[model samples]
Target chain A: MITQKINKDNITTSGDTAHYTEGLQEEQYLTDLERQAIDHEVALVPYKSAAVIEALKIVQHHRRWISDDSLNAIAAYLQMSPAEVDSVATFYNLIFRKPVGRHVILVCDSISCYVMKYGDIYKALQEKLHIKFGETTSDQCYTLLPNCCLGCCDHAPAMMIDNDLYKDVTVDMLDRILQKYS
Target chain B: MERPLTQYIHPGCPPFDIREYEMTGGYSALQKVLKSMTPQEVQKLVQDSGLKGRGGAGFNTGMKWSFVPMGDSAPHPKYLIANADEMEPGTFKDRLLLEGNPHQLIEGMILAAYAIQADVSYIFLRWAYKKAAQLLRKSIHEAYAAGLLGKNILGSGFSLEMHLHTGVGRYMCGEETALLNALEGKRATPRAKPPFPQISGLYGKPTIVNNVETLCNLPHIVNNGAEWFKSLGNGSADSGTKLYGVSGKVNNPGCWELPMGVTVRELIEEHAGGMKNGYQLKGFLPGGASTDFLTAEHLDVKMDFASVTAAGSRLGTGTMVVMDDATCPVGFVHNLQHFFAQESCGWCTPCREGLPWVEKLLLSLEQGSGTTEDVELLQMHTQWLGPGNTFCALAPGAMEPLQSALKYFREDFEKHVALRRCPYQ
Candidate 1:
């Protein structure tokens, strides 16, 4: 846990996270699980702010996306300004600031995948989901986004629906894959 | 014939568990280092091994270690980072090592940390590698339990802590300085060199950041010694085997740990099972996206750092992304430029501004809307965005394929201009 920073004011300041974490009464924004996860990440690093990316990941893992309120809470917890946290958050492609669906499909669009008919998979997905890139489905089940290399170029046209990577994914495989999700 | 790095890795089956790893002689190097060697001896052996980094820039691994501020009065909490950010397009070699045998990498990291006298270490992995992440977490837990990590490892009086830090998607973090900035709870913009990561990095402390593959070679080098590792190379002074991969229209697109100086033809034909039946080879990015494209004429070029450099491209990640005859060169180059533009980090004007401009010009050519003047503009970009013009290597690396594409595939660009339509389309 972020037992390092526990301010006496009963709020999680950057220095004293213990009192703030212990005094969780009325602090309903970040859940006990979320706080605990963030604390674990914070403990790994020397500075609490250095845990911003990990903390963001933990919070986003629990909550589907990072909202303004969530970002503010993260900022307050890390003793960083909301803008500062957002600067770090927005710079990364994976940390979604907007609301995401239950599962986000990151389709690889790099050269290797492009050579292997990434366009075809992307087109088929657009038709199936009835949504273009960066759009969520009406049911909030899937968010389709164009991603860079998924690190499995050997199996080009690879993608990740949340954490499960669908490799050598074909247009025909899309239906089967989507069916498993929602 | 000995695939030291990947011999134990059996694909389809789960990666070697800790018990399996130990059974197969994992951590023997750590045991060796702890028992009979000093940190200097380990670094000297690696330096003599001629083992260069496998992550694109082939810098001498031992030489990199030697620059650290060592000794008792040196900086405390010295860091050793495993740069597992394998975002280079068409690059997946590191992923195999990261996923296939986590313990081998752990032992390699411990050796590297000990060589530099680092107190803390992190495996800075990319975000999309969720499977690798899970396996790594489990493996790390096992290492802790086995007493291979944490306080006074193997009772050698040398203590080090390890952590797995997953990066959220930023290609700039591939650069060590930018990786440092990102680790410091900031944007992934690179810092100036001279005060390099060896001296000041990661909270302004001494740090040594190495590629996952580079670090993976350490254990083997320590176990087998310098001469044995040198003999593993394909008869070029460049020692050790490299994980070379081929993607695109190849019949069997895969990665193999081959002798370092093996010919490109060998990697593309024998190991990757040659190109797909219909798709004849046109040209290829000898390495990953950042490398200049090498044509059929360059197939005989050795897949080593110097040879690839001599051929006007780099042995980046040692993974080839083939360009088949059927694929449009303009579209192919456009796709690459688009990736670079999207990932520029916008830290400096040249990269941030020049890359998007280059992508637009390529897009214009691909869509048949480009004039001959646009080609001239692109040619200008290739020069203007050369090294030292950008904040980092992002823009320069972005220009590699574009410049080479124009050289080898000029007809294609000119054809698009003359016809006002994609001939391939």
Candidate 2:
């Protein structure tokens, strides 16, 4: 509806075309809920662009990984250009620009985990999932990625499946943990 | 013996609700502060108590709060943020305090906010701490419902609003200035300090960013006298109890609330149950991964700020990653350097460029491809990336383990090159 209203404007200049085209693109990318969530974060900060990271996280949470269209929609919603938002997006490791699988497996590759033989666990994951780091399984069951400390150093060799943190993870336990996610 | 911090924090059980928290003398500090003491008095009390930040840097917490411009002239809607972005490896103390009794942290935040007269408060948590996030969200809502937050907190005529802002997984957000930048929705990059966060932070307003453990100490300092708080320290000049943790090959790896000056030996042998059966404690990172390595010879060194620093390493986060004889020092340090190289915010040239170079050097050594020249280059990079060289402490901190490892484990590096293979493998 917003895009149609903008497109039907009589004074269609090049600048106006670009403006309505952006509006239509934003309409194409965002649903009402995503827009509402972005608005909530915008209310927290001083400027709209200040919510760009939160806006990206919100959209990514809705649509699993941020596509170019999703990124542009967030850019338009937060009043930041796509390049500006992309700059912020690429800085953080967790923001998935590429598509991940049904479950994202973040394996701890930090010092403590390394000391406790996280390599063996990573190897076990590779054997079971048949995927390397940053690759998704063919069935889209999981995407394996190396992460820094999950902050459970006491229980080292930790991994997180989506929001759930798995501590003291061993080679044999991988199948059980992975099965629950699938 | 005084575990003031973890007394109410029971692990394996769900966190204490508001009622349970109050029953266990939780919000009593906030009530005490609002009823009798002024904000200055609270700040002074904390400063006198000798509480320093638990998040790596051991700056005096009250002194940090005192820097905020006070009275009607200060910036309005001044912010108080709890730096709950616990990404530091081997440093898992904050998550316990955050997950155990969240109301304790909330009550503490209210006390700290009241001290600095901050109108808004934020818990800038890291992304992976999902459980802590869920508990904090519910606890923040409970505080608002109970008149402890939102407006006219506890009817003291001072209002405080609390919100939880989860990061999108950036280690750079652990830096306070970077945290503020992240909170403002920019990339998590550190800001230059001149007008510190206390004067101008979080949307150009006076802000106080306290670590999770530091904020959790507020209510206790206010409820207990300065002398009482100081007395909690175990003979060290530093005050209050600290949450010390042990990771890696220890027979029992866990965190404990011990006095500030507990010896490294006590932490390893008594608390962490003396490393695994066959593994002798070769060396340890006295704090988190960022701190310098302390060898078995430094076992008697007290884990206080001054004592540990005097022993040639910061008592960073009070969580030691113990290295056993079974583990290879070259590989151990290499893993940490890899993390630092990837985490550099790229805002500065030295940290962004120098870290990956150092990482490559270590990787080469671990792979037995390094020479004497490569080892010399590692030494040069350490000096080049030392304090005042980079935009922030990230690069300097990255060098801590490498520099100290080179000093203590020089033979280990040499062994890899001489043998033409990693000795441990």
For candidate 1, what is the lDDT? 0.89
lDDT, candidate 1, A1-182, per-residue tens: 33332233423224543444343332457898988888887877778898898888888988988877677678768767666788888999999999989989999999899999999999999999999999999999999999999888999889998888988999999898999998
* Model 1 stretches astray by more than 4 angstroms: A1-28
- Which runs of model 2 end up more than 4 angstroms from their true locations? A1-22
TM-score of chain B of 2: 0.99
The model with the greatest lDDT is: 1
Error of 2 at B200 (Å): 0.9
In model 1, chain B matches the true chain B with a TM-score of 0.99
Query: Candidate 1, which CAPRI tier?
Result: medium
Residues B1-425, candidate 1: write the lDDT tens digits.
Answer: 98999998888889988898999888899999998999999999999999898888899999999999999899888999999999999999999999999998999999999999999999999988888999999999999999899999999998888988889999999999999998887899999997988999889899999999888888899888999999998687689999999999999999999998899899888999998997899999988999999999998999999999999999989999999999999999999999999999998898889989999998998888999999999999999999978878889998999999999999999999999989999
Which prediction has the highest TM-score against the true structure? 2
> Per-prediction TM-score, please?
0.95, 0.96
Clashing pairs in 2: none
